[model samples]
Target: MTTTSGFLLDQVMVTRGETRLLDTITAHLPGGHCTAVVGPSGAGKSTLLRLLNRLDDPSSGRILLDGIPITELDVLDLRRRVGLVAQQPVLLTDRVAEDLRVGRSELGDHGIRELLQRVGLPVEFVQRRTSELSGGEAQRVCLARALAVEPEVLLLDEPTSALDGVSSGVIVEAARDHVAAGGTVVLVSHDLAVVRGIADTVLVLDHGHLIAHGHPDEIDYLEAGR
Candidate 1:
């Protein structure tokens, strides 16, 4: 399979209502690796990820994938190739089985089983209603749903922010494995510990601009001495 990867932004800016939420920024996410975006609250980390998935377009400048501009792609096709998983999982009116069975019809059953196993869910979850899922269960289901679309790039915005330690661990491992399998992952989180566990590179954002960018070990040492 062809490994999926993309560039990020070139002096992009974002605004909401009357307030400037994100300032001009430029950063390149290395292909085929997990890049962890970390910072304090209101640091514009989540906004950056949303821009990558086109959930919210930039007010100025542009986000590019490869060398092509993002706005040039078809919205539906773009979303299919780029999956977004938020901190609080949202489920549609469908069973867990039907959710994961969305992308391909032939392997629906097998796909659901495999996804559940990958996300640390038991086979029993297949029949469960989306409404009845617990916090951890819901997040895993959301992940499975994202993967069902066969997306090449996954954008996670605090995906484990609402889960317990055990639950977070499962999702972290799932993210790591996906990257290892040639998929690109961009994760936005404030949890340094979580970043240390899975991130290959780290991007520190503050006030909507690129503050620091380097390997996780570099930041780990910097944080240790502070």
Candidate 2:
């Protein structure tokens, strides 16, 4: 699988009437690395992730993937290349297996089982109904489904927030593995510990503005809360 060079946000901004959701945010997410976006609530971390995948377009400026403007790319192709595992897992089908196979028909039963295992889920869960899953279980299934597509860049929005310690570790390990295999990962999280554990670099946002960009160890955690 080919890896993407990375993403570039050049003066990206988003506004809703009088509200500014993002304010001329500019940053570079290096390829083959895990970059964490962190801050207090309503910091626009999720908005940044959504913009990366064209789930929401910026009001101004450009977002580039490997030096090319994402606006010029096909929306469907862009999403497939940059897969997103949302904060809330939205299962498309009733059955877990069906949900995983929705757009990834190339993934067979064996592939599905492997993906489940990667996310610390039991193979038997494949036949289970999506409604029967716990919040954490459903989240893991969503992560697995995203991996099944083998996207070049993975955008995770607090992916482990609903999970237990073991499950969270499993998810983090999967992310680490993805980066090691040449995929780029952009994570949004409030958990400082999770960011420190997996992020090579950190971007701090506050009230829709870029506040800081540095190594995880170099950031002042206290200031990020404000």
Per-prediction backbone clash count: 0, 0
Q: Which ten contiguous residues of candidate 2 have the minimum total lDDT?
A: 217-226
How would you encode candidate 2's per-residue C-alpha lDDT over 1-226 as one tens digit per residue? 2333698899999999999999999898988899999988998999999999999999999999998899999999999999999999998899999989977987789999999999999999989999999999999999988998899999999998999889999989999999999999999988788888999989999999998898987889634543
Question: Per-residue lDDT tens digits of candidate 1, residues 1-226?
Answer: 2222466678898988787767888778876789898877888988888888788999998888876798999988888988998888888756888777665456567778888988889988889988888877888888988987778888888888778898889889989988888888899887778888899888887777677889987774338532
Report residue 50 deviation for candidate 2 (angstroms). Answer: 0.2
Best TM-score goes to which candidate? 2
In model 1, residue pairs whose N, Cα or C atoms come closer than 3 Å (at least 3 residues apart or on different chains), thus clashing, are none
Give the clashing pairs for model 2: none
Q: Estimate each model's TM-score.
A: 0.91, 0.95
| Candidate number with greatest lDDT | 2
List where candidate 1 sits over 4 angstroms from the true fold: 1-5, 103-107, 220-226
lDDT of 2 at 70: 97
C-alpha lDDT score of every prediction, in listed order: 0.82, 0.91
